[model samples]
Target: MPQFSRHSRRGRILIAIGLGALLVGTSACTRIRTHQGYQVDKLLVDSVQPGIDNRASVEGTLGRPSFVSQFGEKDWYYVSRDMRALAFSSPKPVDQTILRVRFDPAGNVVAVDRMGLEKVANISPMGATTPTLGRHRSLFDEIFGNIGAVGAAGMGGGSGGGAGGGPNGS
Candidate 1:
């Protein structure tokens, strides 16, 4: 019978641990890509004309204003917020703008200013919490479009509109 050395066993154990670590590390590696966002249209004094830029044009350009000046209607605001999942990451308003476009009685693109996030107040994590919005329609009821109906095994599958956008926006 052949006797194996203790050092050999230890070496085998070390090799197994190394291979396991390599496999685990390789499996964990993944790639996530971020696509470029659309152009952020904001008020630029030199570019935007006050009377030329109306509510429709403004909305068409920037989608929607984040906020409007409480003091003045002429002054519009655009604010954007983003929260990083990393621990202890400071909550930040990634984008903000004070659309300062002063009009001379007529609604023409007057002098405008594109402010940075500094214009808006930084929101702390402790601030207001977002509330959960319940589903508009139950899943099963949507597909079937039946009143107060539940599907097999409580699976909400139907043509009706429900929690999820089924065939319709329902």
Candidate 2:
């Protein structure tokens, strides 16, 4: 009986160690979740010199911009985002960057600007219901409002039936 207990105790110890290791591995993986976009390098961004790099050179050096301005063709934007999420929660922004490069009419880089996460704005609606100018109506009101608005087909005037309103003489 003493030998059997020793063997069973050793088995239990091994099982506990395995279970602990598995849990640690899984939790580590959950914390390591990271999402990246653009992945711009600081050296590459600094290499782009305004008034010196044209569109072709800029594209060759830093690849292509993430997006071009909709209103102005000469403006380009390089956007980067890094997000981290643990388990099932929504990913939170760890880092974000928006590099705006403006070009002159001649296609030469005229200005370079950078914006960080500090510039981000979150907008929330003020109330549970949006206020409007028109009167509020329920489903019953909308369905029954037009019930008495229509008349019988012949009760109203027919085409060209008014006094002295025909093509020929009355």
Candidate 3:
């Protein structure tokens, strides 16, 4: 009986400790929950001295850029991010640091200028995925949806035909 009581007491202690840890973890994760978004950063290199700051030297000084210029190697992008909440959702960029190092024909760091989040405008937030307006159900949409939709009957699908104006003041 003594040994049984000791075992039971230990089990209860372990369960209590586990529950305490779970509560602490769940509560701690909800604090602040800050988030940073992915963007090209507001950094634009007005000038760069190629020989002074080459690709290799730049890489060694600053970390790798998030993206590179598509047209040429003259441009570099340093992207940063954080999470919003613990759930899976895109975060708003609270901050951005874009260091544009323009190279003078030769590809040297001519000038080094940094752009922080302050330079970025609210109108043009970071991120390539712009929040575009959703498509409204229009005449063309109905036609496209109903083009092959006629045969879609019994396929558990259907569409309503309501008069809707078209674009171009028609």
State each model's CA lDDT, in order: 0.55, 0.84, 0.61
Per residue, candidate 2 scores C-alpha lDDT tens digits across 1-170 of 99999999999999999999999989876854565557788998999998799999988987888999998778988888887787677777788899988999899999989998997676678979888898899999999986865664555545455467786536
TM-score of each: 0.39, 0.70, 0.41
Tens-digit lDDT string for candidate 1 (100-130): 5454445444556666657666554664766
Output candidate 1 Cα RMSD. 15.3
How many steric overlaps are in each model, in order?
12, 0, 14
**Which candidate has the highest lDDT of all?**
2
Residue 13, candidate 1: Cα error in Å is: 5.0
Q: Report the number of backbone clashes for model 1.
A: 12
In model 2, the runs with Cα more than 4 Å from the true position are 1-29, 123-133, 150-170
Q: Of the candidates shown, which would achieve the greatest TM-score relative to the real structure?
A: 2
Per-residue CA lDDT of model 3 for 30-140, tens digit only, reads 634554433432232322345566766666666567677787877776655443444344455655666665545565666665677776655656887666687767787
**Of candidates 3 and 1, the better by TM-score:** 3
